[model samples]
Target: MRYARFTGLISVLVANAIPGTALGQSVRIVPDLTTNSIVVFQGVDETAHFYYVPLEMDFVRAADGKPRLGVQYFKEGDGDSWRVAVSTSIKPAASDSELAALKAKLPKDNNVTLSPLVLDFASSYVRFSEAKKPTIFSLESGTLSAGSSIAMKFEFTGTHDAVLQALAASGPEVGVMAIITPDASLVQGEELVFSGAAVADLFEKEKFLLLNSFDESNAVVAFIINGNHSAEAAARSWLKSKLGSPEIGKDDKGVWRYGWDLTRPELLADLRSSPKISLPTFSNVEPPNKALLLPFGNICKDYPDNIVNLETGTAGCN
Candidate 1:
């Protein structure tokens, strides 16, 4: 894994303390809902350094089902160039006090705050530029047989400049976003629906998309589909169609999953098989689980995980 090489680089960046010119640096943490990973951008003026820290174990979940971390540091990478490194032996703090103590070691003046922005793949749409007034192609509608070459746009927030920068710098490539389907919605035979209205509702409530940058607001994102497989199977099939057949197998919990083995160049060529626009990062998230931890490192000891509110620290669970 490319991220395996940056283990020491992360320690030097996080533990050695921010440089004396710390005022010029900006640290923003955003939850990538698609991958269930925390994406941190250490922005310095126009250029930014990126880090992707996965919540592998002992993490909390927000009301909206987003994963929250308690001072975690594990993976580091350059989003612009697509080089990643992760620590293998690192783990989350065992207790709240220990987590706090670990946090205290950070640079005193450092402003490490979470960003309201997030990247979601639950419902995705692509806008075609061939028409006078761009038409939308919804991935949920099924396979797009619009020939081999097609042009389209994927909408995203302007606040995601760092992510956009990374994608733009990487040039043409297939960008994959993990699809997180709720257990309740997992009907075996029924097809799942992801509509633009749902995305609009989410944006209206959270203001997740802030169209500040004209250049970064929208990018060419491809969501190709074919055949009549179930939603989950369709997702896997889409990847397989683009990146070739994946390693089909079961996980430790016996749940089936698809794994792909290809170099960066090969993956990019396969994704760009058709003359289409491409994004940089690509991955998926697993299904939801019970016994989720709180953002403050408190475990919920009851059912209906959504009832426990992080703001008031109330709702019965202790």
Candidate 2:
């Protein structure tokens, strides 16, 4: 793995268990459009579920194991089954003993063998498989270029088509961060402060200044997405009156920022208010909040001034 070689994947977590506990069995992570934290669940449903914690990134250990990310391995109320999200430093057990311990604690109902799964602890880019499908997790070696179109999950499809179509039809928004590679390719773009259909579209960091999604609350979009160069160009053409040709300049510090005095105020306002989008929730997973699907994360591991909250767990089989 690279220094910060991290990626995303929907995975199974590990924890201990007790007999006769009817707490939960499966994990359900709902990126609440209403806030920055995710509503974590296990058990048959949400009501019996417990622990709504922060979905951290990269480090398996999040600053004293501050509830990193992972799906619960055993049912709810089971000993430590929900405490998962591997740390880089804490090595996993030598296999057999760990899995055996897990299998023993789980209910006779659909007991499973624990599998080591990779994760993009930062971005929630995952498609869970009901049939226990195997997955491959890889990382991009370099950052994308400026002006290059970046797509989320180049291997996945239909990330946020409807919203991308809207953005493609509408001009770009302010306070939004569009990712670009060194070569000026529009690798990806994001509306850091917006939600709903708008968030369904943004997938990368902002090259320009960032806008707060909310006061002290960074409730970002729930899904990863890519910019459609063709669609964006076509949309800009359609909304010429609202869009303007502005100068892209850098400050003394060499940070890239867009000069937007000529941009449409209405468009800017719309983009500014588009944060906090609700993703479609799964009734089968957790029924209480059907309108609770969205993405929440930051591209911090590789960031220069960033801090890493490393964590580790010592789980053993009974």
What TM-score, over all chains together, does every model reach? 0.17, 0.17
Task: Give lDDT for model 1.
Answer: 0.27
**lDDT tens per residue, model 2, 199-294:** 222322322222223112222211221232223333333223333455566666997665433223455565457565221211112122111122
By lDDT, who's the top model here?
A: 1
Range of the 10 consecutive residues with the lowest summed lDDT in candidate 2: 1-10
Off by over 4 Å in 2: 1-34, 42-48, 58-318
The superposed Cα distance between candidate 1 and the true structure at residue 262, in angstroms, equals 47
How does model 1 score by TM-score? 0.17
Candidate 1 residue pairs in clash (backbone atoms < 3 Å):
3-84, 3-85, 3-86, 60-293, 143-225, 176-282, 178-284
Candidate 1: worst 10 consecutive residues by lDDT? Answer: 1-10
- Candidate 2, residue 50: the lDDT equals 28
Q: Model 2: how far is 167 from its true place, Å?
A: 36
Model 1 over residues 98-146: C-alpha lDDT tens digits? 3344344434554543111111223223222223243332332121111
